[model samples]
Target chain A: MAAPESGDGNNGAARMVTLISSDNTRFEVEAAAASLSQTLQLTILDGGGGGGDGIPLPNVDSATLSKVLEYCIKHAPAAANGGAPNATAVDRAELERFDNEFVNIDQSVLYSLIMAAHNLEIEGLQSLVAKKVADMIKGKSPMEIRRTLGFPDPTPEEQAEMNAHMLEYGWAYE
Target chain B: MSGTIGVTLEQSRSRTAGPVLPENHVVSEILVRLSAKALLRCRAVCHSWHRRTSEAAFLLVHHRRQPSLPLVTFLAAASSSQSQHSHASLDTLDLRLPPLIGVGWTPLPRLADAALYLHGSSGECHILRCKRRRYGDHGLTTNAPAYHVLTIGSSAEPRRIELASNAPRASTWWFRCSERPGILLHGCLHWALHSSPEKLLMVFDTVTESFRSMPSPITGTQERTQLLEMDNTLAISWMDMCETTMRLWLLQDYETGVWTLSRRIIFPVTEMRSVLNVKWCRFYGTVVSQERYVLLHDSHSSYLFHCDGEGKLVRKFCWSGAVPRPAGHIGSQRASSGMSSSEGNMVLVRGDNHVSFKASRV
Candidate 1:
């Protein structure tokens, strides 16, 4: 754990700090709030920052990190508010809408999010990303699967083996 | 656009120093996208990936995702004794089984000098046996043997066959049992080895030739034994001690070749006097009707309350109402009707219902 005093002082809320991405771009956020990412949480807890300085994230580039932080900012509040008391019909609909919109992403960004979520121990993000990938590839043939995932073509023998084994699993309905 | 090579000084360095992830990252990315079959193939790609994909839990989870197809039963029969001219006397009743639709009983193949058994489904039959010879007193016999078991009706051919004869030129296939011989069910095979009277049940494999010995799940002190099938699930009924209650056992798992206990259904034992003779009480197979109702009858006119899946008596009526036979008496009925599929249903024989009629169908 690095001491918070080592970081450059940006905002002094005593409970908030700034996160500097790999590109040196900085965003002010509550220290308790930025700890949503398990990776960041450990670093912040060990660093002992009274929210007087900004922490540096060398691995996460500015654009992807900013998108991740935006997700945290929106989700952190509702979770802190103790979630839904009785889960009314309207609350369920609103949460569903928010989840749907939050998961929309391009392929590269989605892949990056999955990797980051896995590294950061973010359960919600990991499931959303894995489910999205599974849904896209379901019912697709091997060739289509390769194309969709940008996988390289297999050798002829490898292709033949796959076809033989998957003979029973192929769905005629699709 | 500015990040392209040679477009700007900063872009050129960025392109040269960019992090290129290893092939494993790509492999991981591809793994989650593969189908169940595709995932299985992914193992041959490398040893590490193969170990991960072949985990039993993973295969079970993957298999659970697929829809469960209707199970097909496979039955095989073979003669137990070496009697050359005599065939084992057996009676096969194709009662109006509801789960099975069409059925007019087809005459099974006559036993040759060799062992013989027949397997059937709906309207089809297949007789599987090893090649054997039947010699005439005139000393006439064929020098060659038949290679395959003849098809009696509609069942598929056996995957393999064996002729266990001792002729110098005879070739036999592999089929072995170290202890007791196995019992063949409608489409499955089972072998029951008894450690004691209490621990008696059978174990069998539906797909493989391997035999498993299992313990019976029935609680003893039951007066009589009854076995019932509800949608491929086997339920056994027996009377508990004191002859005042009936205990029913629903089988839970069949994969391990064991009849696991699922539920224990109890009923207040009904008491009735026998009209013909005051014999001991016994249990028999249940007769389920088209209305999804199960009618359980004991000896004589003693009819008990009818129960559904939940053990609740849906209705109780005089046993004579269902059958025109007189109450408090044992009577035999013998009338064979041409069994049809839809409109013309065959009458089920009750209380020692015997089928002595020959099949009119060839």
Candidate 2:
């Protein structure tokens, strides 16, 4: 129980920390869950974001912050157990399934998730999103990769250059 | 390639807290996660990407971040009117997974005679020479190789590692490593040497660059024994002559050489009662685990079964690459050696997490 130092050990709400997103939206979450982010862990550990004062995340929008909080909440228990090696296969499969579904989002939202994960220093979220993006790159031509990953369609000049590069470096193409 | 594609991207770009592929740090992080082939193709994306991904520093980081994938290589001896072993080639079976797909592979260095087999894992390569009567004349089979060469990517000269003089005659015994390469675990390469009355595992410490031996506690006249890295500890999977059953033994303590019978993997096979009820089946012995189930993949039989920790058959996949030579290979490699009917010498690199070979040549 991460009750704030200010709490007299009776206030039930003392276990929660409030986070303020860039859009000025306030989100109250368990200190254990919020501590999943290394960026927020210190503040949570120091009893900094309790009660009236909330940790400010100026770089994360409200939409992304909510998503990040959802992930942190889901994974906090496993992280608290120090990656619980004794976790049953069913539990691990459940977490893996959760991880697989978490990243199945719009490309735009995926990029946002990566940035949020990176900025908040969430290693699990960072790797999950990176793996998702890596899957899109495999077995696809450069043009197809750009198209699939939501990159702006290359102009004719850029397309010509890419073709030329492929021709020049045989290993770069299939 | 339409308005729908970059619509969200455009909206995200308007916000202050967003990243695109242009962000070198973010992009580099994603690039390093790609498979070896996909990473190569990424160079064609642009001149800048080629320049950035080609840097030695980036490669070092990629190698470190490299999710160890199972690499399967097939030796295709180019059929010629001359000699069978003279004109041959070895290339990796490029099957990237998590979805179990892929099409092509870049050919590895072409060996003139199919004498040397290269087994690489976690960036270290062990060049093993197959046992042949020809090597005995050169005083090779008589003496073991005493060098562990270290060559950092693209370095001209490789630093020769000094192996101890007591390094037993490992060439003939290690050649059997063709079926099972030396498993690298806890900063050492382990090879189970089943030579004589005494069976021991040869451990080559990467840090110390020296050799040490650990005697195995479990003994079997069965011949199929491989050192596996199970959950980070040393484990050996051994099957009897019947070939229908396998016993997995876990080393409880590295210091005391204690062994524990972990699980029994009963392969789903119909054993024929040969002559005097001495049951027999073709060879099938290699264990690779998934997150939930342990999949024992027989490289020779080309049949893979996903079994529980108790080794109960949960599901199975028929992966006999009986279709055709996988895409990107130069010629066909027929399965020979007077054993079972093998299409090619199928070898999967050790400790691969994303290895899921389905009904495709992928």
**lDDT tens digits by residue: candidate 1, B254-320:** 5553665544444333423232134555433232421223334453332433555444555433322
B7: Cα error in model 1, Å: 29
Stretches of candidate 1 off by over 4 Å are A1-14, A47-52, A81-86, A155-158, A161-174, B1-52, B55-362
lDDT of 2 by residue, B1-362 (tens): 11112223322343333234434466778898876557766776655566667654565466445443332333222432332221111122223132222233334322211111112344432222232343466565554443434332323443455445565555534424333445556656666776434567777665555567787755443246655666667788777777777778888988888889887767555422221133443544445432223444433333334456565666543332321211111101101011111222212221221111111110
lDDT of 1 by residue, A46-121 (tens): 7743455677766667777777776766555454445546657886687668777877877667666666666566
* Most lDDT-accurate candidate: 2
Model 2 chain B is weakest, by summed lDDT over 10 consecutive residues, at: B331-340
> How many clashes (backbone N, Cα, C below 3 Å) per candidate?
8, 1
